[model samples]
Target: MMRSRLTNAPARLFSTAVVSAPKPAATRPSSDKGGGGGSGRDTLGRRLLSLTYAKRSAVITINKWKEEGHTVRKYELNRIVKELRKFKRYKHALEICEWMKVQEDIVLQQGDYAVHLDLISKVRGMSSAEKFFEDLPDKNKNRHACTSLLHTYVQNNESSKAEALMQKMSECGFLINTLPYNTMLSFYISNGQLDKVPQLIQDLKMNTSPDIFTYNLILTACLPQRDVETAEKTLLEIQKAEIEPDWVTYSTLTSLYIKNSLPEKAAATVKEMEKRIARKNRPAYSSLIGLHAKLGNLDEISRIWEKMKSSFVKMSDTEYACMISSLLKHEKSEEAMNLYEEWKSVSTSGNPRIPNLFLADYIKRDQMEEAENFYNKMVESDIKPCYTTWEILTWGYLKQKKSDKVLECFKKALGSVKKWIPEGRITKEVFRNLEEEGDIEAAEQLLVTIGKAGHLSTEIYNSLLRTYASANKMPLIIAERMEKDKIEMNDETKKLIELTSKMCVSEVPTCIS
Candidate 1:
């Protein structure tokens, strides 16, 4: 059953492959030895990184670089591929790797092959990546390449393939470290195969040593079940095994403590987590701010926010969003707005994520006027409002009993979303309001919008029927429309059809009195 659920899960669970291969150090081409190209020309790597994620080819760029009489070093090309992978430009990364395969001067190592296989998995799919792995020369099918394919299998939720590969790796003596085991553990946790986790951990202990990452995965598996007892035991085991508990370990424990309502333990764990925070680790700082927010430690949040601001020359939108969200959780809107302004000044792209936060706060407080103004201001500033923004506006109008505005906002929301199913509650409220007002045209328009979203249900059609019944108007095309939409008729539909059939257009009033 759990395996069934995993089978139905979507592919590409990870944006990038999870492998233990560290990036090679950056090395400039020897051509850059004399005062940076002398004509202010960019390096091959720089030109490659500058290419957009559109339908462009990295091979074309490489050819152009070679035409400029520049030497294309293998190390520089590898660095650029890594950078492209970092930015999630999988398509271009694969192109570059494919180009490297044909260059006489370029010879790919085992690690390069691993990276290539990983990129193929991301750009193409699991099947293509499997073929690439199978076609690799016998000498190139080393530990790294095998591990890379295992990552692809695990991420794609191909449990059988991953298990078979793991067995093969073990037979080949490739399971020398905890990397492959850790990958499987991650897959188990994500797939909700918790019962399999402990057994896997046991296997790791018996077959190979469990590293800190392995222990971290074990602790993470304990989270959804709120198994605090197991988490504490694992922490102790980490200490006994002499594996240093990193900030991630303590951050996770702090969350567990908070979830179990042990605030004191959480607070103490937070201190330990902070103790392990590296000066340049922004993620750790964010974790600290988030944990402090959960503990309602506003003072600690402020202290950590200041520390983070001082540590980095520039803060990312994510960092600002985290702080603003934390402040908002404590009802500190003033501080949140200030941070939003600071973000706006520095933000290059007019991302609507930060603006939606304030909009949500305003709507929650029944401040529709402020919400409308804020939405308009965001649009004026060229920030495209996402579905959440429109959904917020729709709910606000629903609360005010403005059916017209509610319909307008719902249409806008539908336009922005690619595939969205209307929530039953909001759908009920919107159609009910329109039905009560006898707005048959609005009801039909809303029905068509929802039908286009591909979520038309029996109840949704019934809402339109109810609007027809309230208006005492016969819908002549009801049967044809239901058949076209493939909605099966039920008791309610039969009753409404019978009722409308008896209502004569000559006898009924043309308009509601």
Candidate 2:
């Protein structure tokens, strides 16, 4: 069952007192009655019970009963309506409420009237709820009843309606409390209407002094907007007004500082939280870990992780993955591997990121077989290898002159454009190695492949052109191809082309020889 926020009223008010009203005894109906008695009541009673325990079945039953000639009383109808509203069955609730409205001589008590208004408010039919409230007899407009109507408007995001109700309550000599004001302020903040916050605070200062929740509400609103300067000023004002900052206040400040890229300040706030409250919350540890990682302070990250581990902080899978990757980045692969092994041992629930990090470590150590094994393991675990993983495997195959494997990996890399690919020195080395091994055909094919893929550079083009020229076959043809491809040639390249053309002409021996 979903708990209602409104149900936090004092226990004394909520307790049900047994009434002394007389119970009506069951009597056998006359045989001439048009509707059957025992069977009909039993079916209706079963449907009513289903409304509480089995909602869908209950809806089907209720509709079936209504379709038949059964007359559902206002009290019984209201019970179903209340259940529907609680379950967020707005359409059904509306249908039932409209049906109830048409029945004559059905006088609803104050509590039932409030429930109707609440349903109307929840459905965001404010005009309907307003009309209902206005039609109610003046004698029934008690403080609690008016407050319920006010909260209905608030829940519907209709602050102006709630304010009008508050004014009416004040006119009726009801002592207006901070609840409505806090609610309105929260609405304004949640909707990103920060300009309304100061005015609300001013109104509370002039009329009823603001409470801690009021200040906290303002701070919570300000945090996400990155309005830390205003939040800080508000904190000082809160302190001057004798309101002590709670855990929520500090947490908001920590998060705000982190958002503004002030990790040092965020860390300081976390320290303050640690000292001010002996017991810490989950967010505090999360903030610390995030801040330390952002600062590139792996030592501090390790310290915080150790503390969290000892204190039994429930680290999320993402946090665990980040820690492992950080360790691998710092070349503490042994420690990372140990942690990965431990995590695998304890965690029945699998995460792909851990294996991905392990695969990265294997690539870094030039352990291609081990890396391929991890990739296979990832596939077995139903974890799809990301594009970076494929890029790593591609480079590994290229280094080992595995042309078929290279082609396979290249396709995978191209599938995801955002993943990293080798550039500059490493790419030059791949081409150079291919050319030296007398695999000019494969090397030229790769050049065209990379050029089509937009990864080939002028240096790579020049290197391939020089190799072809040295072979003394189709130097002019290759040069013309480079020109047609719009690849820029430097001084050395121009001179090489001229010299190769002359060498090709001279190598054809004269007829006298």
Which 10 successive residues of model 1 have the least lDDT summed? 1-10
lDDT of 1 at 350: 83
Query: Superposing all C-alpha atoms, what RMSD in Å does each candidate have to the true structure?
Result: 7.4, 18.1
Clashes (N, CA, C under 3 Å) per candidate: 0, 0
Reference-based lDDT, each prediction? 0.81, 0.63
Poorly placed runs, candidate 1 (over 4 Å) = 1-42, 53-56, 64-70, 138-143, 157-174, 418-441, 457-459, 462-477, 488-513
Question: For each candidate, what TM-score against the reference?
Answer: 0.81, 0.41
Q: What TM-score should be assigned to candidate 2?
A: 0.41
Model 1 clash pairs are none
Task: List where candidate 2 sits over 4 angstroms from the true fold.
Answer: 1-156, 159-175, 221-229, 256-265, 276-284, 291-513
Across residues 1-513, which tens digit of lDDT does each residue of candidate 2 receive? 111122223212210011111222122222212122354455454454334332345445655887998766676666656555555655555555655565575666666666766667656576666666666666655555566666776676665555555554444444345766787788777777777777666655654677878877877887768888888988898889888777667767777787888878887876665555433465566555654555567888798788777877456666677778777777777888788777776666576667877776776688889888878877886666766676677778776777667756765666556544655655565666555553445556666667666665567766765555655533436565677778778887777666666654322112112
- After aligning candidate 2 to the native by TM-score, how far in Å is the CA of 21 from where it should be? 43
lDDT of 2: 0.63
